[model samples]
Target chain A: MSILKKLPSKARLEQVKKLSSEIFGSTWNPNNIRNGSKILRAPLKGPELVNYYGVNDSMPTFQDFKKWFPELKLVDPREAYRVKMVEDRKKRNKGAPKKKKE
Target chain B: MPFRFPVKFDIPKHAYVNARVLRDQFKRIQYADNEVTRNALRYLARNTELPAKVRLEAQLQLTSMPKYTSYSQIKNRCVATGHARSVISDFKLNRTAFRERARAGLIPGVTKASW
Candidate 1:
């Protein structure tokens, strides 16, 4: 074997690289710099994250039900309790002070 | 259900919602809503050939978006009771809820382990 084996020329090497990339259908990035293509190729996590909690039944609350059927005159237990407490407090003269008419 | 968040997000809410659970729900919605735009901005910010001024602008815009829009802000909490610790992701329940449901045979294929 020869002491100094001749290496391929720079132009020949470049040609070979271009041909290989073309054959393999790969990007010909000569400078080998960041292109950020990976970001575009990445799968979106939004749909999966949004669906993590499953479907919302969208159950209507007491207020919503009452709004939909105003004629029903639904009495919420908590509201009733609050009204009773306020009434008892007023009877004992411990209720909120009346707003003075300006 | 209580309309707790500052802006009402159209997302599912559990019956036992509290401040923490509401925060998580907010993060989830923010992330899902901005994911595509965020990705596009990230690509623009990272592309080396892009003008430095444009890249910096993209970076600034990305940072200006709410921190809640990042996936890292999301945390998995117990869906049943809003418990933070020892949650089983598959069931979305904390250990306490998981044990109770398992014992009650409410969870399919879950049985008491006996040696």
Candidate 2:
């Protein structure tokens, strides 16, 4: 019945992942890896989970990490680079929003 | 050196309600119901305000009480009430992601280059 219950899990996860990536600066990785996947998955635990939960001193176990992010995959650095480049290119083409002259 | 006596302090019931009650309640409901409730509880439990309120209540209770409770005591109650268990299944379900992120540098303080 609480407001928190209404948020979509997938959307919430995405938001958390974005925040986690920002705070951890890409240091978050699940413990699984596949040779061809575009994403890197790491078990969420210890400091990472604590950070994600927004708790100052709580430690999250591997099991805790798994519960929150289910779509995690091993992100190859090369693949990540490729993805980043593509995204950057798209952003550049879109260009910054035009500033209004005062 | 003189022998020092250990001073014990207790946390209040309001603190328990604010810091721990909602979570414990949600977990209880989540476990007692089916998948839908479980999923709903997971989302509901994420509310930042709820936990803060609980904590505030606990603080108030602690300030007003005669007999004080320890932090561990509060934690044990939460665990005993099954608040901590709801997420364990979710954690197990998401283990793959955790592993993947670990392999990558997505986790803070973990280097990506090392296998």
Candidate 3:
């Protein structure tokens, strides 16, 4: 299954869609298929399953928009921070000692 | 995110940042939650005629993971105010906060409805 090979014709596309429908029934999310040289997209499916079973063993993924666009830098603040939970507790409860001194 | 008590802060910036961190923490552990149940179910569903004792053990393991880890535990709250109950998806704010902001023209292209 050389999935990298482009099937650029209506006859080739129906063949792939038929094959994929047989393989993955419910979980087969499809793709937006395009027509050649016209700014047009035909409603279609089986691209995801084609990529999944044909190219990749696992599921296909959404394209990484952050890599494509410089402005959208995704960051999880948890990576950039430490809360010091024990210190926060001590400061919050300074009047009443958290632990008894021996 | 719902595991942590809604953080109340005098400053909106502190509250929003704290909530964001908690939400990210929730995302981190979510895989573990799904993995525990998924593996257990797979053992039951895919395996053929496993010993009753082993199946029971798998069920027990699935039940043992914290209730907090369940998908139901994650909640959307207003990032600005930490209001939990009625947060709307579009602006991520509870109705009260959304109304205030929309009325004040803080949220672009949204206007309060009058009947």
**By lDDT, who's the top model here?**
1
* Span of 10 residues, lowest total lDDT, candidate 3 chain A: A48-57
**For candidate 2, lDDT tens digit of each residue in B1-74?**
33221332122222223345443333332222333322233333333335656545545644443222221222
- TM-score for candidate 2, residues paired by index: 0.16
Off by over 4 Å in 2: A1-102, B1-69, B74-98, B112-115
Native contacts matched by each model: 0.63, 0.00, 0.00
Using DockQ as the yardstick, the better of models 1 and 2 is 1
- Sort every candidate by lDDT, greatest first: 1, 3, 2
lDDT of model 3 at position B81: 66
Residue range with the least summed lDDT across 10 consecutive positions in model 3 chain B: B6-15
Model 2 root mean square deviation, Cα atoms: 29.2
What is each model's TM-score for chain A? 0.42, 0.22, 0.19
RMSD of each: 6.9, 29.2, 17.1
Task: Give the TM-score, chain B only, in order for the candidates.
Answer: 0.81, 0.19, 0.56
lDDT of 1 at A76: 100
Per-residue lDDT tens digits for candidate 3, residues A3-54, read: 7777589978877887887787532224532212121122222222112112
lDDT of 1 by residue, B1-115 (tens): 3676666775564345767877887888889889999999999999998999999999999999889899899888888888889999989899999999999999999999899
- Which 10-residue span in candidate 1 chain B carries the lowest summed lDDT? B7-16
**Which ranges in model 3 have alpha carbons more than 4 Å from their true place?**
A1-102, B1-55
Give a tens-digit lDDT track for model 1, residues A1-102: 977589889999999999999999887889888989889888988877765555465566677779999999999999999999999999999999998887
